[model samples]
Target: MPRLPIIHKTQLVASSRLFQVEEVHLEFSNGEQRIFERLVSRGYGAVLIVPMLDNETVLLIREYSAGTERYELGLPKGKVEPGEDLFEAANREIMEEVGHGAHHIQLLKRVSLAPGYMGHHTNLLLARDLYPATQPGDEPEPLEVVPWKLNRLDELIAGNECTEGRSLLALYMVRDLFMRLNR
Candidate 1:
């Protein structure tokens, strides 16, 4: 079997609100070459959290995703506004999507989504000690908010119930943090 080609160079093809698609040219170790073989771009996003309320419950949101064409359960998340810092974006999204603001916010992690093919990255945030704040004047789209305990968190993660990418990452990271604290 022939070895796959490696990308030797990339050039910007086009850019949009969230990302820039690039065309990559590649050369195989065995001397084969290809042009414009890959499309890549970065998307900006924020991940918000509803931390354990009283050591047991977590706030979650359920809604239908047009992109996935499925009803999904996850925490509040959305694209970062232009020129917005990731942490600020997370806080803004949480309030907009979940109707609660984070009193304490910690950036848990920053990761790339499918770096091999895409340029999208997400910031995972752990927010705790939430309280009711002023709601957005424009009505938020329909969402179902529910609280679940730590025991049930695994069930949500295992069952593919939390389909939102950033939400799942944040949840898993928080779960790991909790496990470490208990030890």
Candidate 2:
């Protein structure tokens, strides 16, 4: 196995209200040194929730995605407020976006979109036993809550505008989890 590279230095090159780009200098074990640029989040990590509306149904949200320049369908997600619990953040986001809160929440996994150049981590959560709830959210416009069947995830991907990788992957993971548990 190869040893991890040593970080020589890291410098902030750019900053924005939502992101920070940093330049990282690294030296390999074999005397190879390189400088790489990556993103550094200014806050704690985020949470992506798969809010289950029923045994076979999951609640998704359709919201405008500036990165893709269109509305995308995916699970409710938000940043973890400083010092806030990850599960609490997931429940809060689901309630604010989907008009429901979960009584049971399980951590699915933590994922990185592009670990090669991005430093953001989103903890995936599976939320169940939901009840009607809502709180004011920071979204500029109200989101459309979509109910999707766990067995029809392929249709959700093939026919709908669902495109967030983390949400898609988490949905599949939760579905498989249900399958394994049911068996």
- Alpha-carbon RMSD of each model: 4.1, 1.1
Error of 2 at 117 (Å): 0.6
Report lDDT per candidate.
Answer: 0.71, 0.92
Per-residue error for 103 in candidate 1, Å, reads 1.9
Writing each residue's lDDT as its tens digit, candidate 2 over 83-149 gives 7899989989988999999899999999998999998899999999999999999999999998989
lDDT, model 1, position 49: 60
lDDT of 1 at 89: 79
Cα-based RMSD of candidate 1: 4.1
Model 1: per-residue Cα lDDT at residue 142: 65
Cα misplacement distance, residue 181 of candidate 2 (Å): 2.1
Predicted candidate 1 versus true structure: per-residue lDDT over 1-183, tens digit per residue: 777788788888787774577888898878877775334533455455645555556778787777788878887767777888876777787677677776778888777777777656666777778876535624346677778776576688678767666776676777778778877
**Model 2 Cα displacement at 82 (Å)?**
1.9
TM-score of 2: 0.96
Off by over 4 Å in 1: 1-20, 27-45, 48-50, 137-140
Best candidate according to lDDT? 2
